[model samples]
Target: MTTPTAPLILFDDDHYMYVFEDQASAEAGWEMPDEFTVGFDAPARPLSMTGEPLDVRLALAGEVPEEAELRRLVADHCRGHLRGQVPPQATALADFVAALPREGR
Candidate 1:
């Protein structure tokens, strides 16, 4: 039997983001950096999309100096990659974040 895969999305607090069929596809499409690793973990707080506690692991170099910017970039890339198959929940997530202002900006 084939193992089930969970849907994934690249999200940002502001700017860009997108939904993917699964984590592997998302990672491949994004060409995730070697230093970065993606995994499913319970978020510190519940997220609107999954509605359960879940977050993607993004390990990168030295404390991600500009986290906000990096997130925006990731989201932007995802938006392009996820041209089709934008799930309702993911759309809601995008819309919600789009409505928000950039952090401390």
Candidate 2:
């Protein structure tokens, strides 16, 4: 219902100036941070977010618990969510979809 002022906050899905709150609480939650749009964009520019904001931190806590496939997909989704248009993976996908947990697949 509201955004947290805590330093470790993430995003949700409300479409307010604040990004979606922590998504990890729901089924579709990717266990990633919901970023603030203003941080990505230049304060002076309109509708433009080109780089990681000074205030935003990209690092997640601890090692990613998911398998490589899930981690990669989640990372890709996060990048696209925050930066838009994530690039091709450095390695071959290599049965990435096949590797997902049954529930994930």
Candidate 3:
């Protein structure tokens, strides 16, 4: 008897379910970063494109930092890569920081 193999799970939001298909299709659809560990979320989280309240997932590669530390790290990364100015997004780091419900800021 042959042993059954567990399904592979790849996590790009758009391609999340592509694992059910063949390897080529899965490879073509897999585009999420290889790094990152899920950490941090927003207060009074916003709705998704489907208009459903969605939990915001933020991640950082190895060595996930504490909230305050993460904030500083993100500031540095953005300043360096964004040329000291980040492009506008519906939700942003500053917005997330300010939106925190506690005195951590």
Among all candidates shown, the one with the greatest TM-score: 3
lDDT of 2 by residue, 1-105 (tens): 122211222223432122222322221322333433221111111121222333233333323232353334335554655466443343433333222222222
Candidate 3 residue 72 C-alpha distance from true site, Å: 1.2
lDDT of all predictions: 0.35, 0.29, 0.31
* TM per candidate: 0.27, 0.19, 0.28
Residue lDDT tens for model 1, 11-85: 543434544454445445544343232222111111222211233223222222333443444455446654663
lDDT of 3 by residue, 3-105 (tens): 1111212223322111212223323433333422222222212111111123222222233224454354444445654466642333555464443222211
Give the TM-score ranking, best first: 3, 1, 2
Pairs of residues clashing in candidate 1: none
